[model samples]
Target: MQKNYEYDAVVVGSGPNGLACAIQLQRSGLSVLLIEGSEQIGGGMRSKEFFPGYLSDVCSAIHPMAAGSPFFSQLPLTDYGLEYINPPVLAAHPFDNGTSASLKSSLYETANGLGIDKGDYLDLMQPIVENWPKLAEDILGPFKIPKELIASLQFGLSAMKSAKWLSNRFKTEEAKALFAGMAAHSFLPLDQLSTAAVGLVLMANGHLKGWPLPKGGSQAIANALLSYFESLGGKVQMGWMVRSYGEIPPAKAVIFDTGPKQLIEIAGDHLPSIYKKKASEVSLRPRRI
Candidate 1:
């Protein structure tokens, strides 16, 4: 809105979140610039070709969360070459004995394979899976009073427990392993409070939209978003690793898709002391992949 500013908005990072934010802003008629540190963007969605002819995902492999996303689902990403390949078996957990438990898009089908825990798994997931569309908005967003009150309350009560506590409901190791595998995606200890929420949300996503892989690898998702953003007149720069606020171009608004450490490092002086103290207190550990 300000002519003196270099751009209406500047987004730091070219990850999915950054791309989505830039795309939305550009769609709303804002002049936006997206910057990425790496030569290639994508962040978690980025892929590497370790072998001569094959590609491997750097961080994330499967994508139930993105595929099932209400916002992403509504986007014209598919039209922009963002094809998702949903394998029949969404996710699986193998045992030492060579037996494995797997999940599918069908709730009843996946539950039936859990042996004795079938009944319990069905009972736990039935309501959540049934109300996924209604719950997606509130569950994936900031805390608020949900329009679907009773359903949200039901999901909240169960989702608030630790993964270990929730796992206790299952008798079979297959069921436990499957659920634990999903919960571990949260990157938190299973005994920690609210860890079950991550597992539940992931599982619900699997049921709603099976864990999918982008047709051309994870990069396709980022490329699709970027292409769509560019279609709306957005601009992007790669390998511009910003070290401080001074390195950034002037803009009316700035949005970061980075960690607390990065934020503090780049804009420490501008940040309030109380906010800086809180940000400094955060100790982010590397993912145990």
Candidate 2:
């Protein structure tokens, strides 16, 4: 007997990734059902007045990555009422000496602000900024040998070294502290590997595209994405929690925008032991890394 199905696909979360996934599926001429655990549409993209008359971003505030994202750059989010406010400076790092270093979209401007480390900053960051267009595809997607190899050595070097090791290249406190602050966003100690890549990529994005803020709140981003998806005939359900595989409406495919725990909890024994074993070792955090 043919099973009664709900949609072509069911997206398990309403976060940025989930919304993007649904939108992509819908764009491909598939009927999609977007389910959100919370009553709110956006997940971490949510913003509220935590304090009276004052609104602050709980997770993502600065968005160099989103502004420069190849995927998002293709979307007509502005038509959905999403607006970005670009600040004059991408980021500013202040020191105890009553001085600060500013990062701007222009390579010369940012490098020039580093004072004694001016040359060093340019030397270290120039390769990254120059090679970004070639590396963006591999860096942002699955790991693979870069399609452009000759210019990727600098990128590989940063990926393998620790931010602390890279900091040794700079003599000035401003340069060291600035890189370290950006590296700290990785939620890893600066002495570890992979952290330098985070800082390097972030710095490169700042030079390529200034980190901009959403006009109203981060929620505007989610709203815009969702609105676009809805226009494509996608269906959404808020405050819906699927406790088990049976709870999920029949769909040809299911895309989980949730954590491993949520996957394990909802799918239960349906998943292979190996997958469950690997997923059990992972951890969950509120924001994307």
Compared with the true structure, what per-residue lDDT tens digits does model 1 show for residues 1-289? Answer: 4368878999999988998889889889899999999999888899889898898888877899899888788789988899999988988888899999999999999999999999999999999999989999888888899999999999989899889899999999999999999899878988888889999999988898989999889998888888888888999999999999999998988899998889989988899989988988886774332
Q: How many pairs of residues collide in each model?
A: 0, 0
Write down the TM-score for model 1: 0.94
Q: Which stretches of candidate 1 lie over 4 Å from their true place?
A: 1-3, 285-289
Residue 228 Cα positional deviation in candidate 1, in Å, after optimal superposition: 0.7
Each model's RMSD to truth, in Å?
2.6, 2.9
Model 1 residue 123 lDDT score = 95
Quote the positional error of residue 157 for candidate 2 in Å.
1.3
